[model samples]
Target chain A: MSLDTAEVRAERAERSGSRAYLSLFKALGRGWIRDRSQIFFTILLPLMFMVLLASVFGSGDTAASRIVAVGDVAVLDGADPDAFTVVEAFDLDEALAMMRDGDADAAVVQDGATVRIYPSATNSTSGAIAEGKLSALVDDVNVEVLSAAAPGEPVLETEVEEADGGALRPIQYLAPGILAWGVAISGVFGAAGTIVDWKRDKLLRRLRLTPASVRTFLGAKVSVNLVVAVGQTAVFLAVAALGFGLQLSAWTWFAVPLVLLGTLAFLAIGVVIGGIAQTSPAAAGLSNLVTMPMAFVSGAFYPLALSPEWVQAISYLSPMRYLNEALQSVVVYGEPPSAVLPQIGFLAAFAAIVALVSWKTFKFDEL
Target chain B: MDAAIEVADLRKTYRGRRTGEIRAVDGVSFRVERGEFFGILGPNGAGKTTTLEIVEGLRKPDSGTVRLLGRSPWPHSPELTGRLGVQLQASAFFEFLTAREQIETFAELYGATKSRAAEMLDLVGLAEHANVRCEKLSGGQQQRLSIACALVGDPELVFLDEPTAALDPQARRNLWDLMRSINAEGRTVVLTTHYMEEAEALCDRVAIMDAGKIRAVGTPAGFVRDLDAPTKVTVAAGQLSGERVRELAAGETVNADETAVVFETRDPRGLLTALASDGALEGLSVRTANLEDVFLHVTGREWRG
Candidate 1:
């Protein structure tokens, strides 16, 4: 066969994508650390809160030390004496009295049919231990349980583990709340605000004139946002586990994507806000219009169960609600995604549509 | 000859939802031969920017065609984009960036730029201030920086819209030198200005645009000569009547302004001597035809100042 060759005249297309991605990473990574005040608000403060609260609230997974009787109460009323402890009444009264003083781990006093159940909820571990131990001596015993610990934490963390359904740390109920809040603040506020600043700075316009593709630009931003959010989440997860001993180790896989989806959804929202805003102030205004009501009304800061019907209904419109709910269900109740897949799908669908709108509305100029 | 850039019957009208229609650029047409420094001069809101934007492939015309290097600019794809440089009118800059950083950044935008950003700064005479932030620079310095950005890609066609708008005298001269140097390198320059003096100084040829239409196009001298009443004969004369001045000229006579009677003429000596001997004129001086006089005669606007 005769040797024949065809020459190729390749035009420049691949460079656009590579250059655009590099710019995106540079923008996101630098933007994250560059503003020291923002870093503290978005990263450090939230991380500290997650760790401290998770540690203090999540320590309910324990079996207690052997029991000692109070000064007045001699023994268990049951005929089986083996179950009873015969400690002196003076120390028992002193111990029973210690419930108020934080000396005794827990104490029970005779009251009516309605017994006062208290461990220091302030001391979560102790509260859990106190509640668990009282149940063991429930029938025929008039009991007043008192706690010296504050509402958020207990010294002996036990009731959650031996509770009827499953053992869940308080942080389990709280992780989703924190993650959703972080994503909303960081993703929506971060992305939208940054875009506005970039436009104002002419950095974005400069990039638009370049060969950078839209897909590459957006993908890089999302990647950078996801990376920052993942780092923040890692800090939160670490704080929750190590600080409060709130174990979310079981549902790591479910948690990962749940967190990712929340971040993706908000980041897309940020793009939409930034794209549509005429100025940086306008972008901030846009974020405030959405974020303030969300931070207060959504379950990010507290349970929305007690909120008015309309308030709860309003939360349904919020992306935060779905994300927080999804996270809480997985971490707190160990509920699978199927139960909240509809909400996830809704969020994903909203994100897709918003992403498209952002792409469309985002002008290289102020158009 | 195949012009490097060609346009035919280009028209553009902007539509507002409530305000209805405003025709920014009415049907306009012109062409530029290869390696020509062409200037389009028009007053603000006279569709100068719109015309330049359309030709640069930045905006679409309502009706007509623009072919850049024998290619329609409407699609404005990257293949066509890389071949030209555009400095949009009143385009904002990233003030925080140093001049050198600004040049390097723009250079990176081009797929493979062999342009020496340092050389461009040197050409603009901004090498010493390369490290200074753009915002700290004077108005003239910024204008020079804008020019440097436009030339960073070693572009074949450069569209400089009001390139010297805010420049000081010295800066204008520096820019004029840079522009001639770029032309000497054989790059086609299409610029916009309201400065008749600048058009005369910088352009190889000039196209005077008015209210979205190109009124005339030729060399600077030709454009002035092509005006309806192209000639001027000034005299330190008593205020003469509109009719008494008519018989003094080769073509016709008209009032130059409040105190001057400008009579259109092929030969000013004939008209001047007649008035001089008759004592109808005094302090007589024949002025060479200029683009400003041409603009005033044609468009009825004092353009040079």
Candidate 2:
């Protein structure tokens, strides 16, 4: 074809704004999928953490204490079945033998109105709990006998109830926090490392010569990261719910927008590091330096309230903390969407501020 | 119509911790007409790539102005970028994309169709390697893919910076053909290369640059013709006696060594006629001045590249 006609054809074929964005999104997504190491770090690593933690601290169920009741004590009949398992022993020697053999946590001997509890030294925690429950049962029996013989009723009674209506298991808290941590990692490391690689490879220079603007390029990248974040959330929630019996509430849907915001905040930080770092390795190192410590202070593994006061104070500064809290509120605590409005606001502000900083620091060329 | 590129008094300086301030491009000015194949020939560190980058809008010059297709390149005008294609000195591709995928991405960025991208791959003779991962391609193949990406948009102007550098002889020759085809389409081509032979072979007009300055600018033949250098004639050393050689010299410079007798002369025909009559033309060879000689004459230094 003639040069003039070729130019005219190219001009006619020129695609506008969204085409570049979609093409870049597809390219980046395909690249990320093909990189096994990246997939391992971003998705599999967090899922691994979830599995390990869930197994270690299984679904908030306290193990039932085993108690050998010598000669079938009357008090044993009133014991809560969920809290204790009572075993009938013919004599005191049999009950002591059961405790010695590790078959029972403690043995109860009833001699007249006085009852003695023999707690196992090997199983100290369960032994102590069994001893306490047996002594309380003996006191209740004594109160019942005295009340029948003397006054109309006992002076007071105590009732037990959870402060929060539903049991908050450790796995429930960990699931959302781990998911948020994964999102942070993929967002920050993915953006920073890829940008540095592109710069080193001179792809940034090539892109500048094209008609697509920087905004279009970065928008495509951020969109890919967001999609990956959503995928991460799905995997984490499904594993937590199906494998560990983590309860989900209607408010859990709010995690989608929160994840997007959190990814944006992390990606903004990544952009700043990518702009500053000279190489991909350096960018990775810097991202880890920022994200690992942030994960700790943000309470991905535990509650922020359990940290030291100074650490808690610093936690307020970490965007990860806000993301974790927002996700936990909606996913684990079953709080309404409005309950996490402040956290969402904080995350949005962090993303905006960091994005502005990255924009100011960003450079298309090393020089 | 406006010239393809117009650069005036362009200057850029880089400050290094140890080197302090280095002038990368100093008071450089040149113009490339539409549909012209222009070459910037220089040695390493001569600022040819820097000048090309500034004109391509990849960098900001500290001072002076560049009018690319009648528009300022600075501040990154999208309209100007759409009409220009650039192949950088270094070839960089997206991480794991195939050759075709890489060019297709560039086509999308430039708003060209995938068919055009494929056409460009065919144009560069990479159609067979379309499915090959870019990292797996040979150095020459990678360079060709970069060129394909540059032209996928069918730009009116194209900039190539050392496109054939460090390639094998066959690859270099093949690339020369590709470059010729690019220019044959009537696209204004601006090329920077350190190889004098490359500049001589492909460029319509050549600008010789040294130490961040344009030493001279003209057609390759024009520069050599204007050099006013004498041709060298050489033959076996012992073919004739010293006395006879002096007689045949006729006031021209003559130097004799153990292997050959050399003559520097303005009139090669006269010298050849004399050698033929003397019957000392055995193993004789004549050498004409070329772009390398022009570079040495203009720069006052040996060609280091």
Candidate 3:
């Protein structure tokens, strides 16, 4: 075909748009990889958080808690010894001191028929976990006392049940949430910081001078970050499987689309912050304010069901919560694709709305 | 040939944090002919950059219209922007990308080839620094890289805002020649700068802006000639005392200082003849008045701010 032909010109025009998209994506990826700080924060920091959280919450092989018992051994007669290592203290003061000094996870004090557990609130996560275990043990001891009193009078029969899909280890439960958290970090912080930097450097002004639309530029950014998110998921899952013997359900493949949608949602959040902020530092602060709270309330570090009812209600507003729930249902519960459709739909709508808002607020010029 | 750019009654105002309203570009208008080298010359904050930006479609005028290639630039930015090249007044590119990569990206944005980008790099004398990251380049090199990006599209019209503001003397001269060559190839070049010499050296016509308005518009020599200022003659480390000074030139202005003796005269031949007869022609230099002298004549020597 002649170079001046209409067909050739149209082809060239089409190719150039895609070429610009690809070129921008590749350049952004290369720049991100070359900057060690960006890599550490976007990719490595999330993994580090995962590792730290898993080590703390998923190390189920270790002793559950260390309990200082301040009474005779009769009160703990029916409690499981393997669950918690019990220490004997002659007085309640000594037991409370042990708990305060960090020598023990909790102090169990008994006065006649009144039994109380003291777990320091300073270390909230461990304290809550230990207090829960202690309360369950105390209930077990009460059941034993009642059983002894009424041998065959049919005390209420209780049975323990797990979730629909067989039991899952803490690591298995946390892997998907942590992966979603990584995607959120890359989406929210990475996209916002990049936009803010571009605005500050007049790069947006330069781009505005070109024929490329704002959609194309932002599309390239989101595409590159999605690639990073996929790689992040794969690496984290691989590490989990290799180190902790994680067993993913057959429906685990559904997490890919879920993660991508989650990435878009988080990236929209970043775009909004970047558009609203005038400076890079302000963008950073705003992104943290957004993602940090969502990280906690959205079931990234813990299960949403474990939080209070009001907090769980609020988690519905966090895109991360939908991502975590959908990913966990696939990777841990072995739920079918239909099970996550609502979550996927919500995430898609959330991403679209936020992206629209961001676009409306974004300024191509300094004004 | 039709005009490449036509901006009429262009105005833009901004709200300052403490200064209230700032009329960045107040009722500025100019026309750039096809393939001509045009310039907007002014001091800092004189709204030259704002005018260029409005013409380039990077900004919108409050009440005026801009036409590039006979189409409105504002409402149809993408359509016009595809055929226009723009280099901003500030450094703007991917910080981590090499100069070559940055240029290639810009070329692709305009549906051009990487070979074209490389050619632009060569044209700007930046081929040697193609692989160097933008942040690592010297200020002059970065400025040149921006120029290469602007030209990578082989656009019919290119807008350069302070393209040589950060360059060294040699680089600035080289860029001027490069711009001239580009214009010679049937491309209109519009530039803005505070340096009058840059405008005089490169522009076919220049518009002098001050306080957000165009004060005068003409050819470089025309601007000087329009002022009707006299030719300047200086005698370095020499003086013509009163007796000889009166005979030097009858109706000319004379100013003498410790370092030099100066004369502004419309009659150079008569003054030269008198000086030669008096044997007081040592260390003499004569030149026509330039744009700077014209500017001082029109705007006065007071600092703009």
Candidate 4:
């Protein structure tokens, strides 16, 4: 009879353990959804970044460059009206001041036949484009003068062809990077801050007294995070497609799995931070210290091709880089799912390594 | 049948950067019988919490053997977990969860039904406040809610650590009644508290602990009786003159102030009868040794808590 009772108890424990896992999942998910601040930081903040960046650098139609023309130069008449928005300046100093104040991208001073152009130092990219446009216009004027001298002479022409078969707009690349960053922030900060708070509040100690297994507890946490990740992906893609004119292909569906993998990688890092940090503030600070710089270096805000070689090399160290690259491949570049296998491999390995570290450091009781 | 809890020579040491080595629990041993309302009473830093936590399997003692319901509690014995309920000194709940949600979650963790959770809330007189978030609950209410969550599992053994600490007198009294009812259900209760009156009122057996060790363990009445201390009887000083005081004091110690005359005697009935015959019972007051006096006698110091 005693043996039978023990068997019955064991069976009951097993049944309850499974039920506990489900309950824990539901409870955690509900808690996360109800927290107003967490929702803002993890979801709304990234979506806001997407909207802000897409508005500033989005679309195929580039804004005409603003230039301060110091004097009435005949060459200005030959410039492409659509490419330049000329603002008249009384003197060279005024033009230079306008360029300094960022009111203009470039300043053109026509001194007789020789015209000198000064690009704005602060706004280098647009300034360089403006300078190139003005230089081409001056070359066209010179060619017109030379053609009258030598009538019917053939001129050297240059034609441009896109290597990728089409122009990939900045917004197309930026949307995926921003989406990856959102996943990272949600995974890392959510995991780290929650763990530290739970530890400090003695919730973890309370949990230690329960019959629930660690596997069940972590399984619940990961499930809730994954569900939230899926929702985040959906909202991000919908806004990017409908509101921001971000094009999507059939391969974009692959972003779901990639985002989930990336979330796991970041969550593993979060677990490590949570295990190490003794306070919530410390966890937040550490998470920011890790993720903020990684966002830039991993090309979440800009392209890696524009960065120096050393920076691009360092980007290899950030898991966000792999996530961004994988997302960009499927979402922006329209590559097949198989093209992201290497990035998936890297994320999986990173998560595994950091998870081991977290396991080593995590303590159920403060004592 | 197995004892509900058996702890043997438990030792735990903490190394602090400034305090050096602190022996939190050193060579502590005790047993709690089935259905026993046992209390470990001590002042702050007396190792009561460390000892209780070790027994609850929340912390691993540096060296000890603890058995809960006939199985070792260390290394996380799952079979023993469902049989034991623990209410930690600090009450922590899932953030933003209502009282009902917190208890239900605990119930699920223990494999108990949600109805059992609701019943526990009612048992603790928190049924009406079930919808309030746990953080918004008053201190006493939170404590009661924690206790409810602890009992939701319906375990045979319950561990309560300073459950009534910081509560107002009325709340403390209410919690005391709640504790008594829990024990009345035949569950073995191991309570660690610094409140002498609390232990004296609720515990069947009390262990006076100080300096990381148990000074003595016995029923409250047994300890006080074995103390062999005298009871005091006092009367107005003007009612008894110096000559009368000398005559009345036969073999007991007599002390007289300008306001009162006091006598300490082992036989309180004899002294009271003599005072009554002398018509000296005016402004009379009788004082007997309680658990606090027992603690002072055993530990050779006044009780700090």
Candidate 5:
């Protein structure tokens, strides 16, 4: 079709725009790859820390074995000479408390005639196995005494009670933490820091000279970052489930979205931290400082129930905690985002606060 | 035709936190005619830049009115900016963009961006490095490229601040050729520099500015003529008498020492006849006074500073 002069001019303008956009992309892509080490620290490193650390620190292997401190050595009074050292002597309540505190993986709660193992009902086999070992230890000591005094002397052995399955697997524990981290990273790194860096580079100044609205620029960045964050979160969830046999329930549609929303919440926190910082170094540091304590206290690596009461109280204020709790409720507890809407509300509030502060405090030159 | 630039009673005070008010430009006033190669000659910190900024629309004066092409340049009218060009003394560009790309980007700013990007590149003798990044260009090339940027919009008036202030002799000569060619096209050029020789050679008319105001303004010949007339002077050492040198100087005593002497007078023939009588007018030189002498006569100092 033949075009008018105005149409021809418009076409040329469009072509020029396309060329400019391509040039911008090429430079940006090269710069991103060249600064790979920085990207590692800024993007991949924190998430790796979240996943690997949760795996290493949250395993339940040792949780199946009991370590009950023998108090007063009263039961070993008669067999002290012949028995093995460090035999896990059993006391019912103490053993139960040991297993509950996770200090003792399994506990031999011994009475006069019967021995009881109080592991979580989750791992009943571990309790039985632990009891068998304790009974064998007791019989072995008696056999030693009898064999020493009279050759071929017989010993009596009896069965005992066992508790349930041990606490939980590593992947099972880590799913929520990873989910929380993904949310926080999305909000902070994707939203606040990206905008702040652009502003600092005077890229914002160049863009401002154009006719594009501020809202449009911001919307484009957020949209890109959010889309990428979703993909990243999906990849991590898939990996954890497939590799570690983590029972990630795609059960309810709300579960993953809940986790994702939690991720977005913390991402907002990251955005604020990163955006508020004038330089990249400052942004990275501020985000990290907020992330580390949030990770530790908010049950990203451990249960909040395990932390100090005061720490648990502080976790209520932490957006990471809300994100973690919110995700854990969905991914582990089989709850929906609406069921934990209070938590979602808190996390959303945190994100809103951070975003507002970032918007206000952020400047192109810090001037 | 409207005057290219008009500034009346322009003043600019830089308010300092600790040092209080420092007046950078003080009630400076001047008019630049269309097609006039007006020169602003002054030493550093003489408010030359401040006055230029007011005209260029980069700055706002405290109290006076500044009209560029009959419009206020304070808010920087695009109509003015599009038709006017500037070569800032310390302008810089991205090092990564090739010289060609740099020119292309600037050219795209205007609608009828003369496809002369390459022609201009060839004009500046940078055709070979049209694809070379700005960082790789030599200092002179960079400055010329800056001049090329000003030339891009086909502006009617140009503001050149020390265009050749730091260039070497050859580069300065090359730039002078370009400036003459541009001036030959009848475009008004307002330039600031400390080089008196350059002003004398290139400027049609100059304002010898000092202390934030024009001390004198005229064509090169008019300025020199304004100096007291000394159409001729003679100095001879072969057999010159000390009395003869003093006698020739009559009014103010022309320079006299043991070996040589100097003379200045309203009438050269009578003075020469007097010296001839003493047989001491062996080597005499008669010539019109130049700008340097006129400036020294007017400003009472070396032109270099």
Candidate 6:
């Protein structure tokens, strides 16, 4: 009789597909968590970047230049109140004290016709901005004095108005971009690098010989990446709130879907790069080629509005731009979820389309 | 007598950069009987691995059929894979997982218990290093771990490609012993190697391949016995001069030097009788051709080269 009897055949066919998938997922997840280098790239490095970028760009009086005016400062005339916040000191000594103590970025002392402007050198950016606005105000006062002495006099005077809710610091605008940046870096490089490493090591080749299908393998990988992405977003948001006293809107809960969608979008892109690149080094280089430029143009570190109009137009092509806009709307503008529905829709569609493309192109086969 | 594997006229072609179309496995055919240790021996670029991959269902043959365990390997029938174990030439596992965990994970894929993983690891002599990461293991240890993974499912037929390629001599011998033990349990094994000695020592029957074709197929002793090469006799030059040895063998001398005198003869009996009568031929020895010589005579190239 044949050794392949009914009992033997039934025993062989009894392999559990779910257990196989769980095995792969558990193994990959353990590797991701245990490897110090992967953790550094996925979580620690991004968290470090958020802290560094937020501190540099989000903190301090990046909102508006603070000016302390003394005496009858005629030089302060016809200046845009939004340009600087001008405050009064009892005398030149108190104004100098305020400048010394960083309470004021600049001090203006008026001595009759001889008006003198003293700015703190330590706060050079703020001091320079205040100096420029005060110089224009002095010119306007001079024009008023000259015109009044001439025929048909038109007296022009300037009043200092404090900015509502104070100045907008660099950190205020940058907090959302930093969050988006964390998601992009971890999702793109993390996924692509891991896939390339698996290929280079021949791990995928080994797994192909088993009963596991490609769908099960990729499903496990995507599930792990999504979990890691969500965890990273939560940690960064909490740190941003605690460290910087960031005021996030109740609508900030929408960032969860935004983060997940953003992850899927970048993760799909990562799969495409990993599929095309033949080696780990090639994948790393290509990932940098994509993410480095996207970080700059997508307003991760700076506002796209500050860039040239053409560059701003190009930002529309970046998925990071949409994600950043959604996050900023929720965190900065405190806009309702309806305000970001378009961004959410675009990101979801982008993810679905790219994921489909990735599914078509991705393979365990060699390039 | 059932065939554990039956491959017929298998052909797989690949497009090469400068070589145009390269036939990796061209019309290769062989059968591995159940419960036998079958080996495929060849030098580098000899298509041994390609053919084995086709049999394992990892690669598709352009035009042919492969039946493993009485089921077609192509069309991705899991009946074969479920009962077949495979160890690729360079198998890699997750760098962070311990050897025990790696084996257990594979066992879980086969629906086997963790205890079975431990048993396999113990069988392969990796029990001591069970907690060690795969990346931290030595080359031989890693090879052993791969073998353990292959056996974790208690497979009926196993495929091992270059399992002992770069191992030390002792490790290779240990692996041979392990294979023998596995075969003793009525499991069939299919392995590929360029090591003629490994094939001679481990294989019950072997197919010698060259240029993507089987040059010869037989047992180790059968190949050597079938070769037309003659037996050789060598004596110390001080005992028997080359001239004297050649005179007795009558132009059957194949090689000689000042230090030794050598002669080739179809029948070593008469030559030895003559040499014994001479009595001066001390330190005399007779040698027969082996698989290496058979390879040279059959394929006209060194077995390794």
Whole-model Cα lDDT of every candidate shown, in order: 0.70, 0.87, 0.81, 0.88, 0.65, 0.82
For candidate 5, write residues A1-367 as lDDT tens digits.
7656977767765665554444444433333344455346435754586567665665434433544644443333443332222335445576566566545545544465444444434345555555555566667666776889997666566565542233456666677676666566545654446655565533443332222223433444454445555555666666667766666544434545655555556656665666567777777678768777777778877777778998898888887787676666666656555678898788677667866775677543331
Query: lDDT score, residue A102, model 6?
Result: 77
Highest DockQ scorer: 4
**Leading candidate by TM-score:** 4
**Per-residue lDDT tens digits of candidate 6, residues A124-162?**
767777777677778877786688689686566679765
Score chain B of each candidate by TM-score.
0.80, 0.97, 0.93, 0.97, 0.86, 0.93
Candidate 2 regions off by >4 Å? Answer: A1-15, A59-163, B273-285
Q: What is the DockQ of each candidate?
A: 0.14, 0.57, 0.63, 0.70, 0.09, 0.56
Report candidate 1's interface RMSD in Å. Answer: 4.0
**Model 3, runs deviating above 4 Å:** A1-12, A59-64, A67-81, A84-96, A106-164, A211-215, B15-21, B74-83, B236-242, B249-251, B257-260, B272-288, B300-305
TM-score for the A-chain in each candidate structure: 0.64, 0.75, 0.82, 0.92, 0.62, 0.72
Q: Going through the candidates in order, what fraction of the true interface contacts does each contain?
A: 0.13, 0.74, 0.79, 0.63, 0.00, 0.67
Q: List, residue by residue over A132-157, the lDDT tens digit for candidate 3.
A: 88787777777877899989877676
lDDT, residue A319, candidate 4 = 97
Please provide TM-scores, in order, for all candidate models, with all chains considered together.
0.69, 0.84, 0.86, 0.94, 0.56, 0.85
CAPRI band for model 2: medium
Candidate 1 runs further than 4 Å off: A1-12, A23-175, A194-224, A231-260, A271-276, A329-343, A357-365, B90-101, B113-115, B126-143, B228-289, B301-305
- CA RMSD (A), model 3: 4.0
CAPRI-wise, candidate 4 is: medium
Q: Rank the candidates by TM-score, best first.
A: 4, 3, 6, 2, 1, 5
Superior by DockQ: candidate 5 or candidate 6? 6
The alpha-carbon lDDT assigned to residue B56 of candidate 2 equals: 89
Task: Report the C-alpha lDDT of model 2 over B52-101, residue by residue, as the tens digit.
Answer: 88888888899999999999987876678999998987787878889988
Query: Please, what are the lDDT tens digits per residue for candidate 4 over residues B76-163?
Result: 7566787888888889788889999999999989878889999999999999999998889999999999999889888999999999
